[model samples]
Target: MEQDPITLIISLAGGILSFLLLMRFALQLSQADYYNPISQSVVRLTQPIVGPLQRVLRPKGRFDFATLIVALAVKAIAILVLIKMSPMFASAGGSISPLHLLIFSLAGTLNTLLTIYFWATLGAVIISWIAPDSYHPAPQLLLQLSEPLFALARKVIPPIGGLDLSPILIFLLIQIVQGYLSALVVI
Candidate 1:
């Protein structure tokens, strides 16, 4: 039941990279200001791989499929490596079905993606209350990233008594979807 240092390192590195890639994908999807320092850092970190991938996999509309693909691949590789190193997996003969691995990776990717939005939505709500008109790149980026989800929730929830409940609704929906995705993983 003891954790390995190498496994921890791999997990941390993979998770950070995957999050950055997903951010790049979301920033493009949201049409976020590229000049933002955070956006610039994400693009700079991922450009090495995404730049080349873009040549073969051009973006569809506002969706950056290249960044998404890299994120998913990174998640999959991280999961695979961790599973191989897991004591439980070793005890079980270290054999995972390809289908199971695929499902796990996809579920992990989606879970992480939703997690990004979950925090973003929460951050936007807090920022709106704290500094509704702030021009800072971080706040602006959060608002841009979360507006789509809030819009969707607004359609269903709407404002009541001058209190917007979109963030609460979006939070509930994200949690529900994330739970369902987690259920899809067999291992």
Candidate 2:
């Protein structure tokens, strides 16, 4: 948790961008309705960047491969910028390795995105319990985003008594995966 100005600026700005990009990436994957306010806003916020990247890195089905690249690129750039400004680099006579930073960025990006999905899935479960029929875009998006994960969990353990336990079960798995990815960053 470096609090230096450079680190702070990069982290704050980069984190917001990364989160937005991640949101856009998930929405793209879920085939969210663009007309929906939340989905439309995400698209508007990310279109300028991902739109151009899409030209070069065409999508596959409902997947926005371009959004993935842009999100990863944003994360890598943030990591590189932070590394360039770190006191460690100065102490090490500016010999920091780009490869190491790149690895960190990739791991961090994956971890963050997974964490987002974890929360989104939990939100979906909560929403399902509280208001399963809500027509809001954000809630609907969460359900859509969690569908694939829930399906996996359903495969392992089917719902009982009109209750879906996949969310709780899957949430634990997400935590395990997040920890694993974070450990990879250290390596």
Candidate 3:
């Protein structure tokens, strides 16, 4: 798991940017409070890139494809850079084919999105117990972002004894999907 400094920097920077852009996209889709400070920060941080793309992409309904596209591109480029720098890849004497890059890009993007949901759902569950009625933006945003997934889980496994078990199901589902993606991508 040794990484060169340059690779580490690229991965860290790209991951953060991708995560933020994904957050913006998710928040928009979830229709989270636009005025929430966290939402505003995500929007502001991503606007420079998403604003221009929005002009061409034109959002449809709650889906903001531009932000998602940018997030994918960022993750793709970072993976490409890291792959190019890897001695294992270099030693194989193989150039990165476009199709392989596309697969890796998609797998990486989906993985990041799932990771975001995983944490958001976990946070929302904790917040529900600690301060269910708190007006804090973080809890509110987490709850907003996670509600859809929670709803799905609730459908299959309703609350027992007035205790919701949806978060557990959602966590299991996320892990299963991530595992499948890892097996499919092989990178």
Candidate 4:
């Protein structure tokens, strides 16, 4: 069945906001400097939502995965609520099972997270390529953000010719996973 336009729009907005919040939290947790005006503005805008989460889900050791978890939770909840309310507010011509809704929400969150990872990784690679000598903040931030994903990718696909093919492989893997998860929900 075709999705309601209003519901689809709301769901997309919620997913995007949640993803930005999560990415900002991740960037901060990585201790990347928000030196640029744009970066600082993002931090300021998202701080209200993320500050409480950071307090509640305080880091234990060196890493802080709480932001990521909280962000995913927020997106999942928002998507679930939108799905549940869609039937009441508008008709989509077909019924969506609760399990399907849950899976779809999960797939949405995963897709957002994977997209952020891909962009951040790509940004890092680009910065490294362009400014090998310059002391830029974006490159450093990107490297820090991409490290975890690249680490995981390295185990499965090693680098070739001093260039890391892990991010590309990881992006493909994420897309495949998202497709599989989406099929479980809506196909």
Candidate 5:
């Protein structure tokens, strides 16, 4: 079914905004320094949402998973709302059940998050290779963000001949998960 322009625009906007918000939250949760322009921008954009949640959740020490929860919740709500209202704004033909919409939004969110991670990792690898001694904030942030993912991947698939195949494996896994979730939404 073809989506209406208005609905398509709204959905796209919501998806992008939510992706940015979630990435900012993830960076903060990972304790990435706010010294770079990108980091500063993320902080400024996310403070309105994170500030209040931090006050309420008050994570005891270095671990603050609440921010992740809040970000995900906000993203999910925004996506769901956009999907729910899409028919009103756009001339879509297919009947989107609540369950289908929910599944689609959730899967889309996850897909976006993983894509962000992939990009960040790519950036870090590039920066590290080009200027090993460069004091760039993005590389550091990327390193911090990709560590856990890389670690998990390494555990499952060890490096071969000094080349890390973990990322490729993980990417394939993410693609499978995305495909499965997308199928749920359509079926």
Candidate 6:
């Protein structure tokens, strides 16, 4: 399996950027504290791409459509660039159609969202074991991100023995969704 080093580098860089961009999109969607160090850094890192996209795309209420679009674009462009850099990649799989590419990018974005939630849930669970304080930005953000899911779980499972089992249920649910998304068809 011969892999082009350049393509690997480019794809990894694009993936990281898209992940960060999607994080900003999620944070905004969840109404996270914008003044926090993480939120501010995400905004600054992605401002260059998202700033112009916002002018053209316009946002829909709290959701940043431009940021979402930018995240998808990053994935799409990375795949296209990889194909271009290594024509062998195309020959191995046949030509990738535009519609196929779009679906592929969207699936990737969905997978990324699932991944973000998985980490957020994990962090929130860990913090609850230590100190779940609102004064700290990271734990607050994790709690903010995971609370809705936890709420849903509580509605279904409820607490037991004065212990919050919402996190466990949330993890199970996240894993189920992750499995489904991973199996999602792009064709």
* C-alpha lDDT score of every prediction, in listed order: 0.87, 0.80, 0.88, 0.69, 0.68, 0.82
User: What tens-digit string does per-residue lDDT give for candidate 2 at 1-187?
Assistant: 5388767878888888888988888777767677788888888998998988788888888888888788788887877777667677778764547777677778877877887788889899889889999998889888888898888889988999988888888888888888778765521
lDDT pick, better of 1 and 6: 1
Worst 10 residues of 4 by lDDT: 178-187
The candidate with the higher lDDT, 1 or 2, is 1
Highest lDDT scorer = 3
Candidate 5 TM-score, true structure as reference: 0.72
Cα-based TM-score, every candidate: 0.92, 0.90, 0.93, 0.68, 0.72, 0.86
lDDT of 5 by residue, 157-185 (tens): 99889888777776787778767766543
Q: lDDT rank, highest first?
A: 3, 1, 6, 2, 4, 5
Clashing pairs for predicted structure model 4, backbone only: none
> What does the lDDT come to for candidate 2?
0.80
**Number of clashes recorded per candidate:** 0, 0, 0, 0, 0, 0
Question: Candidate 6 lDDT (Cα, whole model)?
Answer: 0.82
Quality of model 3 by C-alpha lDDT: 0.88
Instruction: Kindly report which residue stretches of model 5 are placed more than 4 angstroms away from their true locations once superposed.
Output: 1-5, 60-66, 88-104, 184-187
lDDT of 5 at 105: 59
Model 5 RMSD vs true structure: 4.1
Model 3 over residues 7-98: C-alpha lDDT tens digits?
A: 78998998899999989888988889999999999999899988889999988988999999998888778878888888889987636888
In the range 1-187, model 6's lDDT, one tens digit per residue, is 8667886789789889989999999898888888988889999999998999899988787799999999998988887777666676756664578987888788878888878988998998899879966578889888887777778889998999989888787778767876776764221
Which residues of candidate 3, in runs, are more than 4 Å off?
Answer: 91-94, 184-187
For model 2, where is the 10-residue window of minimal lDDT? 178-187
